[model samples]
Target: MTIKPLIILPDPVLRQASKPIERVDGELKRLADDMLETMYDAPGIGLAAIQIGVPRRMLVIDVAREGEDKQPQVFINPEILKSSEERSVYEEGCLSIPDYYAEVERPAVVTLRYLDRDGKEQIVDADGLLATCLQHEIDHLNGVLFIDHISRLKREMVIKKFTKAAKSKAI
Candidate 1:
């Protein structure tokens, strides 16, 4: 699988909502494989399709701790069905946003429905890192970013910084 280049922040494409996958086929499987490879190479725990310039409802995640066996998971057309009233906060980072990280609050437990890699339907209740990761990636499918959950001032500052960085690279 090829490691695809990430679409960084300030790229307008990241703001576009992804379309749901109509069917799961070999090509889609290949794309998922590539996404996993890319996420692993990025050394990140999760990645969304939009982050790689693919406007599809898909994401790959691996929340395994360092040195533990990799447990790569693919979610196609994932939808969160339920979220706990209890909230939790985690320091979240995105591959598209590079080194920036912030603590974000979200539901501590979530139940989601998704299609697995083999075109089979799966419903799972997730907590801890898995719940947070799923929420973050699903947000991407809806054209949302982790920064959107932060304060307005901080979000604007991050966007402005990335905008400037992109400008310098273009010169």
Candidate 2:
């Protein structure tokens, strides 16, 4: 598996909604493997397909803390089936957004339906960081970002910063 180049913030590709996988085949499996490798190499807990310039409905996550045996998970065409009324706030970061992080409020518990690596259907009930991570990644599938959860003023500021950073890199 190879580490794919990340599609960073302000990249228009990231804002495009991802298309669902019509069929989960060997090619898609290879993509999931590559995504896991990329996420681990980036030292991030989760990554979405669109974040890597793949406009497909998929994500890889491994919330295991440092030094633990990596527990990589793949979610394809994931959809939220249920969400709890209880709310929790977590400081969320994205691989695409680099070092920027902000407190985002999301449901504390979630039930989701997704296809596993083998293309088998699976439903999961998650809480804590896992729930937040799932919700965040799913947002990417819908052309949304963690910054969008923040106030408009703050969101605009973050975008402005990234826009400037992107400009400098192009120089």
Candidate 3:
């Protein structure tokens, strides 16, 4: 598996809706593997295909705490089946929006269904950090960002900051 370069914020690619994987072939497996590698290299808990310029409905997550055994999860074409009325706030950061984090409120519990690495369907009942992570990554598949959940003023500021950083990097 190779570590792919992450597409940062202000990259229009991140705003494009991802296409669902029609088949779980070797190529899809390779992409998932690469995504996991990239996530680990970024030292992030989760990553989406669009974050690396691959507009496919794929995501990898490993929220294991430091010192614990690594647990990698691959979700293809994931869909949220249920969400709890209770809300939780977490300081969320994205691999695409490096170095910036903001508190975002999301469902504390959620039921999600998706295809596993073996192409078998699976459903998970998630809460706490997992729920937040799932929502954040899935948002990428739908061309949404966590910043979008924040106040318009904050969202605009964050976008402007990233846009300026991107422009500086292009110099």
Off by over 4 Å in 1: none
Clashing pairs in 2: none
TM-score comparison, 1 vs 3, better candidate: 1
Q: In model 1, what is the error at residue 13, expressed in angstroms?
A: 0.7
Candidate number with greatest TM-score:
1
TM-score-wise, the better of 2 and 3 is 3
Model 2, C-alpha of 164: deviation from truth (Å): 0.8
Residue-wise C-alpha lDDT for candidate 2, range 1-171, written one tens digit per residue: 899999998999988999998888999989999999999888799999999999999999998987789898999999999999999999999999999999999999999999999889999999999999999999999999999999999999999999999999999
Ranking by TM-score: 1, 3, 2
Candidate 1, residue 38: Cα displacement in angstroms equals 0.3
lDDT of 3 by residue, 89-129 (tens): 99999989988899999999999999999999999999989
- Give the runs in model 2 whose Cα sits over 4 Å from its true position: none
Considering summed lDDT, which 10 consecutive residues are worst modelled in model 1? 38-47
> Which candidate gets the maximum lDDT versus the true structure?
1
Total backbone collisions, model 2: 0
Q: Encode model 1's per-residue lDDT on 85-162: one tens digit a residue.
A: 999999999999999999999999999999999999999999999999999999999999999999999999999999
